[model samples]
Target: MPALRALAAAVFLAHPAWADTATETAERAAADLREAIATLDQAEGARNRIAALTQTIRAYELGLTALREGLRSSAIREDEIRASFEAQRDTIGQLLAAMAAMEAAPGPLVLLHPDGPEAAARTGMILTSVQPALEAEAAKLRADLQEIARMRALQVSAHSALQEGLSAAQAARTALSQAVQDRTDLPQRFLEDPEELQALVANAETLEGFARGVARLQSDIGPPMEDFASAEGTLPLPVVGTLLRRAGEADAAGIVRPGMLIATRPAALVTTPWPATIRYRGPLLDYGNVMIVEPAAGYLLVLAGLATVYGETGDVLDAGAPVGLMGGDETALAQGAGAERPETLYIELRRDAEPIDPAPWFEQTREE
Candidate 1:
């Protein structure tokens, strides 16, 4: 019996109630997911809607991934664990029922009476045999309780994430409607025929072809251009962020793209640093979403990796006008150790279709 008691004590000490660390991590992730959803809900305007929806989707994906990993690490095969718990509970119930029936009769002390000596010995032997089994059951019950607590915590985390995801999806649908309306209400500037523009857009084989087509149309309209050269070293960055990659730096693919990458907060506003005419706005090659603005007659400023864009082609924007927003996905940052990679925006300046270094244009203070 002493040995049995020691074994039970060992089991109890070895498996303390499943630690709350995993659940706490999941809860933290869920809280972030909720905050992201709220941000999406507050976003107004078509451009904001695009940014919000993009961020909301990314948040959902990341939150789901975290919850899955938490569950996998903390509770392997939850279904099997639950089944074992149920079996243990049933056994405990049966044991309790038997003990209760025995209690209704004379107590164990009653067996000490003169006529009950033989019966007392028999009962003693029976109890001795049952002692080890009872102790084992007690140990298993403790394990079951711990497991159930962890499972319950995981369930709550999952439920919260699912609710947040649903809300984000609904908000995205409404935002999409408003975005379409906003696009329709934008004033047209270029006198080019819509059919011709559409055909040109369709026929363009690559981003360069599309840019060339738009340049041709802009040349015909002859929109007023801003003196971008004069603003060099004085212009603010299009978005408030930390510079992560400089122009001429090789990326993970070992390709040196003539552009600078800036890491910004999720759904951060992207603005034009100088007066410009929107020349092109849409997806371009590997750059998820892009906007090409002509700050000068021959110079085009390309902003890429945006989740949402505000201005349409031919629309003239003053210096500091909002153009688009950075995306919210952080998977790029997750690849590096201890890297604070946030949403990134790629900026490129071009002179007659030739890419040029854009670092010289922005203030050094802003870069720092």
Candidate 2:
């Protein structure tokens, strides 16, 4: 039983878990890229086309990122295995050479040697004791060889995945560029002076004040030409992430707010999930950077906590057009310090100044 346990331990130690992890990561990245391509192929209209293309680009980028990470991980594992094998190289070589010498001298000859009966008997007993240990060492060597082979294979697979990811990303980018050029009918509900909007956002004391100030600016652009009420339960999220907070949830200060928070990767691209005109894009209150997009008649979409703002106040953005990016990296200033925190975006949907739950507007399956 102890011998069996030792063998099992040797096998376990020979095979590192990083190889499996890298393979799984590669598989997942491939799956994501495939899904992205499928989404783009299925898009029908300009709005859907832009959205799908944007999503495909994002997916390709993410897939490439994951593949590169997997490649790095695989390389590290490979180096570790090589180092371990090199450390044992001399021992394994000596064991093999000793085994070869033993094979050249038969057991019967060693036992019947002319040295003496006592010496031959002692030699036979020593061989008997060392044989099992030698066999165990050989078994461990075989295991190590197998593990090295597996690591090499994993490295090859990682390299292949990286190449595939790069190719797919390049193709996706090309398609995205073409799609952007083909798009023409993006709706624009309101237009505001960038300078005035920036000043208003900078001067606003609270979110409510910011919202009101935006409402005053939008009063001149006339009502939305389209209705967003019919699009309930179907709108895709602006970013790919996990929902952290729901509407009316209490914050650390115990104050309930009417918005949802999404936790996403650092510097994740933010997009308009629907056709909207940019109303405000700047700092407001405690929110780092905010973008107010009006997507429909009498409705405002407030997306805050961004590290960087992209479009100006008057720019009309179609669904999935780039708006800004989430904060967390060095390029985008982190809002909170001391410890690393996951990038989070606060989103709210408002009808004329009143905050409403945006949960019902988006697909339930996507919220997670």
Candidate 3:
């Protein structure tokens, strides 16, 4: 009987208490880390891919400009224009393809029913505990996928826009070439045609007026950073990037540099762990590819010069959700060839038009 009892005890010892919770938590954490790494890779990869597309786009634009200018010096060559058009067409097609690929890249999402490690220990005491944890994890994954999907849609839209821009530019060049050809004695025509000269002046004035309207709007709205209390002294760099420039000053071009500039690096993974709302996700003059995120009440964060916009107006974005990807080496719409590198992010904080460094606020967030 004693031997029988000993055997029974040994059989019971083979099964440990419900400590599945701990195992589950460990598994989840590992998965989270892996997911984070993958997401970062996708983000950086998208930026790089977009850069290539931007380069191609720029080259095509240059070709178009040169082709148009060529018409001024020599007779318009039908074969040359057709050839350049074909090349431009191919570049545009490639651009659409690249943008599509970038949009498809995935990123991390919030986990809904994440099981705590204690779930493993309580597995024996609770009925259907594992099911709950599994369900929760599923929900979280779904939520994450949905958010990423929305962002992907925005990328698609941006690509569509570029395609449209390319087509418009192509058409304009085509029309201009035809006009020049129709008018023989081009040199004499240009010199003698008062009407044509007047038209050119009118076009310039129209473009200038449109630009002034935008500038006025920007000044009227005021900077978004005004609501936040001053934390100027200790603002930390959001990630491991260098300061390419500062806020409140122009870069020799007399352009209003809205905010501090920071470059987001690969090694420095800057993430917002909390929920945030996208205050603005549209283009602003001089602030190319910009996003304004409000992480909390009175706290505004601005990310500018992204090659692509990944968020939309009124969308509730989580902290660290991709606002945009950096790419394109084009100078400001107004800035001509005398521009710097195509990369870099311009960041800034304000309590109004008053300028303050964003480093301290970002540093505090990092510490938290």
Which model scores highest in lDDT?
A: 2
Between prediction 2 and prediction 3, the one with superior lDDT is: 2
- Measured by TM-score, the strongest candidate is 2
Whichever of 1 and 2 has more TM-score, that candidate is 2
Judged by whole-model lDDT over C-alpha atoms, candidate 3 comes out at 0.40
Q: In candidate 2, what are the lDDT values of residues 164-261, reduced to their tens digit?
A: 54455445445555665565565444444656677775587888778867776644445655568888889888876768889988989898888899
Off by over 4 Å in 2: 1-56, 61-199, 220-225, 330-340, 364-368
Score each candidate by Cα lDDT: 0.65, 0.67, 0.40
lDDT of 1 by residue, 1-368 (tens): 34433443443443344455555666666676666667666664435465455445445545545655565555554555566546545445655554455456666565785657886776667655655655555666666666568668766756665565555645564564456446544445673435656777668676556666666654433655555678878888887676889988999999787789987755566778888878778776677888888888778888889988876677766676667767764333322123344788989888777777888888952344
User: Pairing residues by index, what is the TM-score of model 2?
Assistant: 0.55
Clashes of each: 0, 0, 20
- Model 3 residue runs over 4 Å out of place are 1-240, 254-258, 264-274, 328-342, 352-355, 364-368
| TM-score-best of 2 and 3 | 2
- Error (Å) of candidate 3 at residue 210 is 15
**Poorest lDDT segment (10 consecutive residues) of candidate 1:** 330-339
